[model samples]
Target: MSKTRQHCFDFGVPPALTLLLGLWGITRNNSMWRDEAATWEAAHRTIPEIWSLLGRIDMVHGLYYLFMHGVFTVFGDRLYCLRLPSLLAMACATALLTLLGSRLVDASTGLATGLAFALLPAVQQYAQEGRPYALVTACEVLACWLLVTAVDASNWCHWAAYGTTVLVAALLNWFSLLILFAHAATIALARTPRAVIARWALSASCAVLGSLPLVMASQAQSGQVSWIPPVGLGTTLNLLMTVVMGALGAYLARTRLASGSVRVSLSALALPLLALPPLLLLAVSLTRPLYQTRYVLFSQIGLALLIGAACHALASRFRRQPRRSIVLAAAVALVALLPIEVPLRSAGSRVDDVLSTADNVAAVRKPGDAVLYIPAARRDTALVSPGAFTGTRDLALIENPRQSNTLQGVEGTPEYIRKAMLTARRIIVVTDDNTSPPASARDRTKEQVLRSHFIRRYETRERGRKIVVYVRRADDRAATPTSRCPCFVRKGSTPTPPGVVPTEQSKSNRTQ
Candidate 1:
């Protein structure tokens, strides 16, 4: 080999290599996702009492948000700050995978494992998210180190560490336990042995016992699982296939250039690739809960391991025939992944569009004008959060102001025109609505509900968001600068939402 080639062959420093790899994957896709918007909202919280406010949301990843608070504090909350934690956590996950693989197999296997993990679009997407997926990936891999140790030594500390991993994984996202179940099932099959298994079981029980306090909190607070669209068998299978096959394709791409390696690769890949997916599918099915591809990120390492195994199996198959495993793997990955990445990224684009419109809405708030927001259908916070006018207190979120602020839900049919004509001041009505009622007040069409209620007075198009401001009248000063406004703008630092009681904010006599 040439000297330059030989120099390139030398493995670089581990941490930097992981950092560079993670950065590449994260930046490869820049689209935002729905959950990411929520993270951005949480990370940009402003009230001193935001921690209390955040607790009400039932998001399982409180620790992730706290760290994000610190990041936003320094970096001045923006997309990068929202995304940086996931990026760094992916780097850490890669390093941990390398460590775990090296111990289980060898240096070559470890490097191959890391390389495969780096190319996965799923990993890249989550790694750039503002949520907890990447960090959970890191913890899952680290737990493996302790699990392997506990298998042999049966020591208290090792067992304790293994259990601690279980606790952390469960707390971050309950679905994380799905991966734990997969690993536990694999252990129970006598693949390793009986006596060692018994020891691991006892250790696991202790971990569960220790975690009872935290888990109970979840159980006590657990409301009825939210409504989920019925998932067919096809969707369930496709989700599994995508996670498994997509990961394998990424691994194959990473290791296609390898010359000779079988044992090192297969062992490293077997545990993750073959074990995690089906088990997770079964778990979700039992609960009848909604299942999306990203929720399984906690078990992604297992998928990487599976890909490593596939890499060896393919390489060996091709070795004798000399056909085209590397070429085939590359072809398959691009075909399977590129198509899916487009739509997934499209969903992310929609999320960005939502935020952009929010910025547009914020830019147009006139400081004291009545801010009328008719949430055409459901009360989605994303649409409303941006309506908050960038952290100011001068806006009132009005549903129907033509009626008295003291008036609650209307009972009798006074009619839509009466409601429309009651506002006699300068006001802004914004709706991406779908509410349809008889006696159409604004009448754009059948599909367009709120379009009929008010006439467009001011429209601002900026940041991918369209703020179509409407009003009943052109002259009334509808709001005061001292009233509370929705919080939809970027923050100057990391913050949390204020925990102002809804009742207090809604009191009829409190407004100016």
Candidate 2:
């Protein structure tokens, strides 16, 4: 390590930029997406309920739910309140990246690394989300910092801290433990004293032991990740891009730096951290579909460090011949990416704008309205913003999700739902845009009952969800009060309920 003075400017600028960039549109009141809505539903519940819910689903996010539960208790369930932890964690990760880069190379390299991390699109995206990925990323960087310190000082306390952070990171998101494999690879490639190696081994063993319960429990809840598809060409391309960036960075830094040892050490440290976890995931996913970009978001830190090193190296190589031009070019490149960042900061970036769907439905809703979620999993919309569906009866719901200690609560059986559907004249159906007729017998029954009996009235489509209004056909309407909904149309200055469209200058209006 270089014995250089820590410049205040270098130390202060990265985190400040990170915070400003992070808070740019952090307060936007976009309706929470499915995963975030899941967090909101899980965290707002009582501790016992959260625990019980974890037993059945999302055990991997148990610690995060507990943490957010405390945060909600203190801050309330506002948009900023839910996402602030992620913003702060991202800022912290940026700062730690600066420190890690500075330790591995120089102050300038560290500063550049921090700026690169702050500017990363992935970093910006996760920073605004209300999830464990950002927190786990921060913890991963902090653990790496502890590892560097322990290796340098051979201190027992530093190793213990590293072990504790490792366990905490894994508990936050069990997949974050993959960073340990990268760290182990880094240690194996670097030269270290036997005593330091033993202490490092001990710390890693402790982390594994401490994380075992979460590992086991999350495995039991593995169905939560059933959506992740098997690895294919696209997956390979993504991992390759990550590795290529890291390799380019290492090559640039090595060519520019004077010390071979520092160049070799940084390459060993960064390359594995950048490449190993995702590739390992790809290999494992061939049998057990467990690959997701966010699962190894910590890899971005490694890539950022490499980019920073490369930027610093370029500037260093040209320092004697007007370095200002190099800095200007780097600034311009980062500034150009802001256009891409703008959309990412908005609700429109998401597949489902839940708030927009709610607003559209609210506009068309009327008294005596009933609501149903197609395939049932889409019920989070109502839970996310219950006020939007205040007057509407949830046709399939047998209990409130929170009270039932479930993601979106249990639904009535097919026969029960079919009976409930018949009683309501106006029904609003919520469904995923990609949903097809259900394949299971019970789900098929629900689908058949709706399509065969009701006439489609109005349809509103959003990015990832669709809301359809249905009315019983005129032939199916009976004299019973439950058979017809009140109408908005006025016939010859006298209001009449739907299913009784009067003749002679009939008014056409939407029935609620």
Q: Give RMSD to native, each candidate.
A: 10.7, 6.8
The local distance difference test score of each candidate is 0.50, 0.78
User: How high a TM-score does candidate 2 get?
Assistant: 0.89
Query: Where's the lowest-lDDT run of ten residues in candidate 1?
Result: 503-512
Stretches off by above 4 angstroms in model 1 are 1-34, 43-51, 74-76, 190-195, 219-227, 240-287, 316-354, 362-368, 372-453, 456-466, 473-512
C-alpha lDDT of residue 421 in model 2: 84
Per-residue lDDT over 132-166 for candidate 2, one digit per residue giving the tens place of the 0 to 100 score: 99999999999988887788888889999999999
Per-residue lDDT of 1-512 in model 1, one digit per residue for the tens? 56565323322233344465445434323344345655555555543334554344444655566667778788776566676777787877777775665555444445445655655767766765678888777777777667766765767788778888877866676566655555565575326666767767776676567656555665544552353445677876766675667456546544442332321233333444344654555566566765655566755676565554455446655575221443355347646776654554442334334443443444454544444333322112233243444333212223421132111112222244235334423344444423334232222232132243334444443323334444432332452221232333333211222321111122121101
Error of 2 at 338 (Å): 2.7
Top of the candidates by TM-score = 2
